[model samples]
Target: MADERETRPQADRQLCGLVRDLASQIEAHLRTRAATLGLTPTQATALCELTHPMTLRELADRMSCEPSNITFVADRLEGQGYLERHPHPDDRRAKQLLLTPEGSELRGRLVELLSKDSPLAPLATEEQDGLRHLLTRALIR
Candidate 1:
């Protein structure tokens, strides 16, 4: 039998592998960056969740984190001028999280930084569209 590298399309496999590595690297890089913005990744995610002003419990569920963990993230974000916690008008004892103007601006900048074009931009566009179509068809059942 041939060596594994010679047995298959090595370039294609390497490209896919590199894409996964790049994604991991991006996550780590952004995690560090969140600090420069006075937020942790969890806090940033919580603020992003607040575009809809959900309750702490609901935000915890959406963020797949424990309620206490959500509260900690929210508290930090709130202290950092990135979020506001207000009484839920419908439930005076419950609190809802909302993004402050600064948080919105930060989220926008984070999105922009994460979405900058790469040398693989053209191929990625075609591949991403194809993947989205295929995944949508597969998952929409």
Candidate 2:
């Protein structure tokens, strides 16, 4: 029991480090693609996530951010004609965000760019599947 507890912290630290490294690589790749389309990483993320119209609060929740932050992103996107704010059907004072045609086109391009190559391109298909399974299982736990 003592040995298990002692090794657990080390194992956690290693796992965290690996995850951070992988995230950094993925972020860098995404940032490059976003820049080509004149978008900040957050803006690109927002565009990709808005597959359907959603309230500002819902978007904020999905992005794991504050509502005010989402409002700022939405304002910028609206100014760029990439999105629009429409009155929510159920709430007189609330609004929902919908991507414009331009936004959808750009989002499609962004998806293409992001999907061009896997970050783990060096790994075989089987290895990639195994890694994905392991990661999913860990996340579920």
Candidate 3:
């Protein structure tokens, strides 16, 4: 039992390191793809998350960021003609963010770019499904 306890922490540390490394690789890939369209990683991420109109607070929550940070992102995207802000229907004090037609077009292109071949592309369909299931379970836990 003592031996098991000692190895558990080491195993957990190794798992954390592996997860971090994978996340870094994915972020680097996203950065490279975003640059092709003259967008920063954060802007690309924000655009990707805006599939439908939502409030800045909702966006911030989805992005795991502060509302102020999301404001900056929205400002940049709006300036670029990719998104627009309108008064929320029910909330006079809040604004909803929606993608412009141009934004939607660009988002489609971004999806194509991200869906292109990557490290996981070589996995068989069953393997991919299994990986997704395992990752989902891990995330929920």
lDDT, candidates in the order shown? 0.74, 0.91, 0.92
Candidate 2 residues lying further than 4 Å off, grouped into runs, are: 1-3, 120-141
The residue pairs found clashing in candidate 2 are: none
Q: lDDT by residue for model 3 over 29-131, one digit each (tens)?
A: 8899999999999999998999899999999999999999999999999999999999999999999999999999999999789777655678898998998
- As for model 3, its CA RMSD to the true structure in angstroms is 1.9
Over 4 Å off, model 3? 125-129
Model 1: per-residue Cα lDDT over 1-141, one tens digit each: 477668578876886687688767756766766667666777756755666788989999988878998888888878878789888989999988888898788878766654554333445678978966865775585
Q: What is the C-alpha RMSD of each candidate to the true structure, in Å?
A: 5.1, 2.5, 1.9
Question: Residue by residue across 27-133, what tens digits does model 2's lDDT show?
Answer: 89889989999999999889888989999999988889999998999999999999999999999899999999998898899988887674777788899899899
List TM-scores for all candidates, in order: 0.64, 0.84, 0.88
**How many clashes in candidate 2?**
0
Number of clashes in every candidate structure? 0, 0, 0
Clash pairs detected, candidate 1 = none
Ranked candidates (TM-score, high to low)? 3, 2, 1
